[model samples]
Target: MDNHPTTFPPAEEDPAYLVFLDSLDYLPSDDVARIKAAYAYAAKAHAHQKRMSGEPYITHPLAVAGAIVEWQMDADAVCAALLHDVMEDAGACKHELAEKFGKPVAELVDGLSKLDKMEFASYQEAQAENFRKMLMAMARDLRVVLIKLADRHHNVQTMSAMRPDKRRRIAYETLEIYAPIALRLGLNKLYRELQDISFRLIYPHRAEVLAKALRAARGNRKELLTRILENIRGKLEHAGLRAEVFGREKSLYSIFRKMQEKRLSFSQVLDIYGFRVVVENVPTCYLALGALHALYKPVPGKFKDYVAIPKANGYQSLHTTLIGPYGTPVEVQIRTREMHNVAQEGVAAHWLYKDGNESSAELQIKTHKWLQSLLEMQTSDSAEFFENVKIDLFPDEVYVFTPKGKIMAMPRGATVVDFAYAVHTDVGNHCSSARINHELAPLRTELRNGDLVEIITAQNAQPNPVWLSYVKTGRARSKIRHHLRTMQNEESARLGERMLRQELLSLGVVPISIPAAAWDSLVKASGQKSLDEVYTDIGLGKRLPSVVARRLLAREDMAGDAGSNMTLAIHGTEGMAIQLAHCCQPIPGDPIIGSIKKGSGLVIHTHDCPVIRKSRSTDPQKWIDVEWEPEEGKLFDIRIRVEVKNTRGVLAQVAAAIAEAGSNIEHVAMDADPERLMTSLRFTIQVAHRTHLAAVMRGLRHIPEVARIHRERGGEA
Candidate 1:
């Protein structure tokens, strides 16, 4: 009811529309006219439609347009906001809107419209698809998202009239998705409002309690905050530095999160209110900080210089916590007026594009870089893209320096691999090692603020698959996955070609005798673009090698020589196309059989493996005969479970036993069973063949502390 209209107010009578028009006074008359035309068209389209609150549907768009205008958005954004729901709610077509309003406004409206004609399996799927479409539009032009935030804001304001179930769902989504987007875009006020609204709707009782508590605390702490503000202002005035000091309270959602995260009661959560000092220039910002520190006893390790290194969203301020007059902890932020505007408005300040300001260009460059990254990730699946976007939403940043003194902002808990990728994809791909603060560290080492990072690269080095476990940033994760996928395709193609050649040899036909024309014919028959694609499909197990080989032989006019029986050889280093089963971990001496998995190539499992036994019984046709070639000095991973006495030095003794048997332990884990007197240790070790693994197990069995030892089958401990 705060800002919601309940009737169709005339254009001149509507406060929202009037405020929107007022904001557009600086725009050219032609642009203002175009925006007004859009508003009229939307109002006409929704003439008979009413909101759940019994308000004219036009009021919603008017409210949304007003919010966008408050952000100082462009005229195009304002027009788009007014028409965003027209295509979806009123059956207005994009072509008609384009003819009347323009292509840009039409496209924005089209992007916001849900795919209603196509049926979805569930509400969640439909919602996700809609969000995906909206994000795609935002990637092209950020105004789409600006309009979307406004729409969500107005919806939240009136959500009290909706059904409880629907309200909860919408509120949860707004909190999880839209609120984060607002924060990432630097719309702090919008972000905070969305969060507080959603929090109240989702937990009304808790919100009411917290609101009452906050009001009581505000009344009790009024005098203390006033004294602190006055003291800081006096210090700045005495220091000859002009400043305006004001008390700022933390938002309801922010307070709730802090309480929940720290498991603290409201009374225990001190320093809930802070002070902001707005200065004249950048230098005055530091001067104000010095003055505040001199006036109050500064709290050690409670200061951050964001002015020197801004946040990823280009927020700049100097934050310091001090011990106030009555031993109360008070936090203070100092920034110039321009910096304060950029901090509050975020990307909007840049998009507003005021003349005679270099800050606008700088802000534009920073926003464009972030937007380009989002566009690059658009090729990913909808779920994956959404996840990556969420990861980038909360940028709890840690600033680390390159060896050349160039500072890079990364998410806190980000590892060296993330830093390497942030520098460049090529550098990340070739990165082998790193040195943090002049000391050698693992690639998975967590980087700290102000640490100098030096990445060591080797041309032959490649991104380890394990890097995905530790890297934090979405850009790094997406790039690493992309590189690995390309590498997998190439490796699969090579392996597929070898398998086909071996199948041809089994048919008593020389593989070299197959001409280029035959490959082309096979490519056409298989509907693949090239021979490599056909081979890659075969390698990925999408098509069987025997089937492809027969097709090729038929194309070469040697169909009579095709053989039904073919055997594939494994060399223990088949790369991506052929994977050894981790459950069985078959070695060269083990009796291994191959199963053609869909899109995963050949999976090799031990003959006695329980998983392979079950699969063979259920789907016998998938089984293919495979033999390990006599490749000398090839290591295969095999797991051995050892039951050892729960005594001191028992783990060390077992490790020593395996090492003495000439086996290298790759990984070790203790099974979780507190009641058992004996502890179970699962070890993944590298050995040459089945005989080597057997010898290692026998050696472990001979240890006095080892109660039992055996090869783990099908991942059983």
Candidate 2:
């Protein structure tokens, strides 16, 4: 899929290369020559190209490589960053690069390349497919994403010369996709920068207005902020605590988001300025927190110990709000020096602190786990996969506990089903309900921090389609959807196999009697990868069974309708592939016929149902004889028209009769003829089979207010 550009640009020296050479101290002395070679290669490959800023193309890579250098990446990452765009935009191939540099560097560059060779239906489709490739490669080597973030950072900072619409579109993507990805990886510095620049580009007017307001507010609060910072530093020193206390201002974009989320004016959004106390060790972090609290009265219910249970992105700090000397609010975060580095740099801190830093290692592990989850959520549709990734890129998180007291950090609004999937996919699939803090709760219950959750699962339980509506985490939704899709495909395959077998029987043949070579030939001829694909196509009505039957049998057998008498058996649990007609509401005991409906697969109708009877004669091959397997403990919905005396308590009485007869009224509608003194109540009730319907009808007839009752089975074709 890699489209190697054939026209290589001629090499020419540029001043930007000299500046980039100075930032390579992070690379080993032996690998420095290789990095320079990569730079020269990319420089020549893009010698004639220029950015919208009119800078030589190689400077873009230099800036991206500079950012990764700030994160302290290795030699290969440096080389890969230098040549990241060469394979996509310049004349280069992965094999040549791999032979020249190394496979690792070449693969990194390959991962960063866009899928420009493919045609997509929309811009979103193209972006999603490219991201899908990049994400998959990221799961293999995390440096790919690091280089990508650095690349995105540079692009976002240099997009002023682009058209307004393109600028807004890229800004939207940077904010929605890349910014969250940065935060998800714990790259706080890059995340905030990307969000702020994107917010400016997307809403220029709002950004400038907010910037002006912030400038005014900053001047007014300058003296107060200095005083507070000095007070915290003095107290920490007085308490024998070694700490670096600094004032931190919220980013303009973060302020804007807070205003929008909370619906507040700029003046109403307080706590824009905060403080951070970086200490020598973990114990000193708490000591500094205590010292800061001693300096000012702590605000009530305004403390969070993220260090105890880190956020989903592996962010850890002791955050607290205090009443300052002037009676205004001051927010402070306490953390160790290593925690601060990891907080700002995120996964890149792994390589920075590769010398056995426990906090950095933990963050690396958590990030890899999240990346693996993203990889596991493989969907056929690239856009859908992108959506699932967005779902996982949650900004807020809540920490909860399992029944065994183990902590699990989930998205803020995640429900019990999300928690279950977070535990394991099988657990989510089999989850029936949950116990929250020793009390029974529904599956859709939104979890709270510190609540002990115990998933109640059943062996035979399956994921309900309704779970997709409320489950917050993409892991749960994707797992449930994957299971349901597999189930439907399997059901369709089974039904298609049966249909094919029945057709074969009419031609005096059995499926097993067909040779393996014959089936393989048929599969190949049908242009399907395997026999299951052929069957799935036939079962879904995308391919006609009669046509397939003719292909599998001799020409002499096609002269008669011998196999037309064969009936296909229907299982009650043929989910998604088999639809019971809404008009007839056929139960297990009802005489049923199957109609192949385009897009819907197959619909089962009662034998005498008016909806399919006309279609049955007009299109004879569309209808097939089907018999029910009569599954136990399965409920079927049936509609009944009940004529009742026009009375106040008559509706309640009819409902009670249905309930007494062991049926549930799913829905009820009334049609009143006031002058005739009679009312028609249409009730949709669930029953086990036709006999259960008979019992409900008999119970309703026994009611004194009931004049007539009969099953309702009328619909248009």
The digit string of per-residue lDDT tens for model 2 on 16-39 reads 666566777767676777777777
The lDDT per prediction is: 0.83, 0.86
TM-score of 2: 0.90
The residue-by-residue lDDT of candidate 1 on 247-352, one tens digit each, is: 8878888889989999988887845558899999888888788788889888999999998888777778999999887688888899887788777877788755
Q: Assess the local accuracy of residue 271 in candidate 2 as a C-alpha lDDT between 0 and 100.
A: 49
Best by TM-score: 2
* Clashing residue pairs found in predicted model 2: 506-563
Off by over 4 Å in 2: 1-15, 237-240, 270-272, 325-327, 353-355, 505-518, 554-566, 571-573, 589-591, 607-621, 627-634, 645-682, 714-717
